[model samples]
Target: MWFTAGLLMAGAVVGNAVLIGQMSGREPVLVLARDVAWGQPVSGDDVKTVDLPVEVGAFAVREVAQAGIVGQVAGRNLHAGDLLAPDDLAAQAVPGPGQWVLGLRLEPGRYPARGLAPNDPIAVHPAPDEGVSSGSGTQQSGQEFPARVVHVSPPDADGAITADVLIPESTAPAAVEAAVGGAQVSLLGPPQK
Candidate 1:
């Protein structure tokens, strides 16, 4: 009877060990507490730590690395509850050297009704000014250039949207010219997969 009791006790100890092992397998990793827009700096309040399985710790940013992540620019738009990965961060802010951020005022027909989001790839097309004769060779039409959406505001009372985009310095002049004459914006897709 003593031998049987010892065996039962040993079994209980082993079972408890297994349970502890499973619990310890999880490690702490940082996740976004709120949505972070691309090119925006991540503040301390934007992140929180959660315990996840060890397998996820391989690619997810560990909680201890939070110091390095804060103040860094986001490489892509990140949603709340997302596991923060290293690739989701950028080395510098938006409009990094040689880039310019421009705000384009778009009407209902000028932009997609589906709406635009940060980090979306877009093309700015120059629209001919009203009363400008299309027959005149001096007018340039159908000139579209690529730009990245930095921020988008809700439609105003007049159904106009304000979109701030990051464009290369070389294209700033053309983009400004287009904005002055009313440009058309087309959403290509998300900037990254």
Candidate 2:
């Protein structure tokens, strides 16, 4: 009984020492202090730093990079407590020159059930009810224009989602015409390389 007790004590001490050694090499990284909407600027108060094991720290936004990240637009919907990653920010404003931002008020079933986030690739189709006629005098419902989502809001009391999309200059006129009646947005797969 005495030998068995000594063996258990030694094992506990060795296990604790190993755990402490693994946790000792930590570095500070940025984590969100609050929820940040897509396209919204990141402020100093929006993030806080915490020490994490070096392995995870290697891929996280370093505490030193906070200055550069501040005032930058969020590339996605960053939830509170989310670890800041380099890809989580956009370096420039959305809808660069020659692009127009269009607001799409979509009802449930009109958009993907899974929901949308910033920078999501999408294709906008003319609402069939809108009866937009093409140059050939045919309805434009079958045509889709490529667009990128700038921001998407949660469903409101009426279950309507408001998505702001970046439309190319050439397609902005047609998109606006379609949006005046309503539009159906389809989430596309990840952009190809």
Candidate 3:
């Protein structure tokens, strides 16, 4: 009697395991292969497939659903390894190869209280009247360089913000110069996207 009961319990455990496996909604999904910046194109090279439970997240795009991605643009900065979602793509910008994207740190006094928003046109200039000294210990000044804000970090404990800007390659050197020389970037308002 004891042997029969043990065998029945083992059989029930195995049967339950098989039933759970069948119900486990594991599925294949296409997630970001790498960090795709704001407005970048979504191509096959930017995605990869992996099996995940059915309830991944809202807007999750499946691997088989990638046919609609090739020409679509990233609506915002897509971090590496994030699950690709439908709303993440749109008929928005695809940053050209000639656009240079970079970051700059700015203090509360240096940038506007309203702050820069993504895709907002901006101009980089050495913070006016700063009289800052450079690496050579000589006073340095910089001029405005046209650019667009790609992303803006929320203020830290001290209220400083870091902004990522995209500018034409032809003017990247000047933008870097202005930033490194203590620049202040002006947010022109109204995001382009």
Candidate 4:
């Protein structure tokens, strides 16, 4: 009887251990850029999941495949390895009333004579028509104003590229006119401190 009782107790202990191990859930890990897709499942294998030191509350994680690591999000810099929660990705640029977002499509090795990148300050100079500025001592006949590059499309052999430009509501008309007339767009670097 003693032997049977001991055997039964050992069996119960082993069973309980196995049951507890199975009940524990896997901890959440940080998703990596390569493993993340718009609707793909996030798992340890898909991203460089790390154990965060602090709790993230009830915020849910999302995989934004189209969003890149740049600019400020809630005044925070986004990096490649950082985890993106729902709230972190909620903020977006809201164009004010009468403001416009313009997209310029350029071919490979063309457009923005001085190379363009996101967040670049630029000036638009329209090429003067023949005989328009022959004696004016000005080769180009258009105004130069400040603008910023919001996005840059990837390069392709087909010369298909796109750039997003942000312009004030008041400047839209003149900018559009200049762009249509083969304006020479020059990207200017940020002012030195």
Candidate 5:
């Protein structure tokens, strides 16, 4: 009887241990709290920790890794509830030195609506029918400075697409002045090759 009772007790203990192990929850991981635009900084309020299965969150950024997420710019447009990861963040501008960061407000016809994204190269030109000087003096309608595409804001109330572009400082003032002087500036297309 004593041996039988001991074996029963041992079985019960082992059974309890197995049950506890199986009932344990998965690790908590960081997920986006709201939609974030490209190049926007991530703050503590921008993320939340949630329990996710090991297999699902294995490649995700864990809650422990959320500490350094602040000040990191979004590498792409991030939707709400997205699983945060290292590749989703960037260190701001990747443009070369002495480049100008300028905002260009474009109407629907001025810039391409498809396949355009950040980090793409752009060619500058005078908007169609605007013969105002493009600062290059001779190449009035030809390509201007080779610029880098940055953030592209959603269409505003006026249906204009606002974009942040990086161009050489040498041509920055002249290009902006022309735009301000009622001379239309259009980014024709991404540089070929």
Candidate 6:
């Protein structure tokens, strides 16, 4: 009986040690806050946790120096240990080759669509030039196209904010030339497919 009890105690000790080791080996996931900066400590319940591969351990959030958390969105601050959603990490994915990227300059100094966020579907509307007025003296029918807002830029002198528009490769060339060559290109949200 004494020998059996000793063996059981030893097994328990080994089991507890293994459990502790496994727990210690587990790495904490980095969570990013929408407005927190890289390397900043996360406060309250702002972080989400997820398992990551050992190869990506360097990107893991460590207890010390918690600012390793990075925001998935550009132009926004990210905090450490904040659980990142798909959108948070979407920026890391590279666009497909052959995809057309067009820059739409927003009107100067106006935030008419400040609420526009990246990945938002938008429609492109090209205001007909005044010189293209119809016989009735009104501008020609405005050209409208569909696009996705891949990015938004700060305001610039042209009184327009530049948006990086992604469109099909086949239509990119004409769309870009028309927009950049002073033809109005209004961007609309993605059309319901």
Best by lDDT: 1
Inter-residue clash pairs, candidate 5: none
**Model 3 — TM-score against the truth?**
0.49
Model 2 CA lDDT for position 163: 89
What RMSD does each model have against the real structure? 3.7, 3.9, 9.0, 9.3, 7.0, 9.8
For candidate 4, write residues 36-97 as lDDT tens digits: 32212233343454444234412425223323422213212234566655544323442436
**Residue 44's lDDT in candidate 1:** 88
Candidate 2 root-mean-square deviation in Å: 3.9
Q: Please provide, for model 1 over 136-181, each residue's C-alpha lDDT reduced to its tens digit, 9 standing for 90 to 100.
A: 5566564678998999998999999999999999887788877787
| lDDT: worst 10-residue window of model 4 | 69-78
User: Residue-wise lDDT of candidate 2 within 1-193, one digit each (tens)?
Assistant: 9999999999999999998897788889999999987778899999999999999988889999999999898888898998999999997766668988889899888888888787788888877754467777766564579988887878999999998988889997768866777778888987579
For 69-156, candidate 3 gives per-residue lDDT tens digits of 8878888778778989888887756356787787888888787778877667787876544556777777666657888787788899
- Which portions of model 1 show Cα errors greater than 4 Å? 1-15, 134-142, 189-193
lDDT score of model 4?
0.55
Ten consecutive residues with minimal summed lDDT in candidate 3? 125-134
lDDT for 121 (candidate 4):
66
- Report how far residue 59 has shifted in candidate 1, in Å: 1.0
Model 5: per-residue Cα lDDT over 1-193, one tens digit each: 9999999999999999986775474788899999776666888888999888778778788998888888788887778899998899887644447777787776666676572466566665544335655566543443355565677788888767666777788887655753443223344544469
Per-residue error for 154 in candidate 2, Å, reads 4.3
The TM-score values for the models, in the order shown, are 0.86, 0.72, 0.49, 0.51, 0.62, 0.49
Measure candidate 6: CA RMSD.
Answer: 9.8
Which RMSD does model 5 reach against the true structure? 7.0
Kindly report which residue pairs in candidate 4 clash with one another.
30-49, 32-47, 108-159
RMSD in angstroms, candidate 1?
3.7
The lDDT for every candidate, in the order shown, is 0.89, 0.85, 0.78, 0.55, 0.70, 0.53
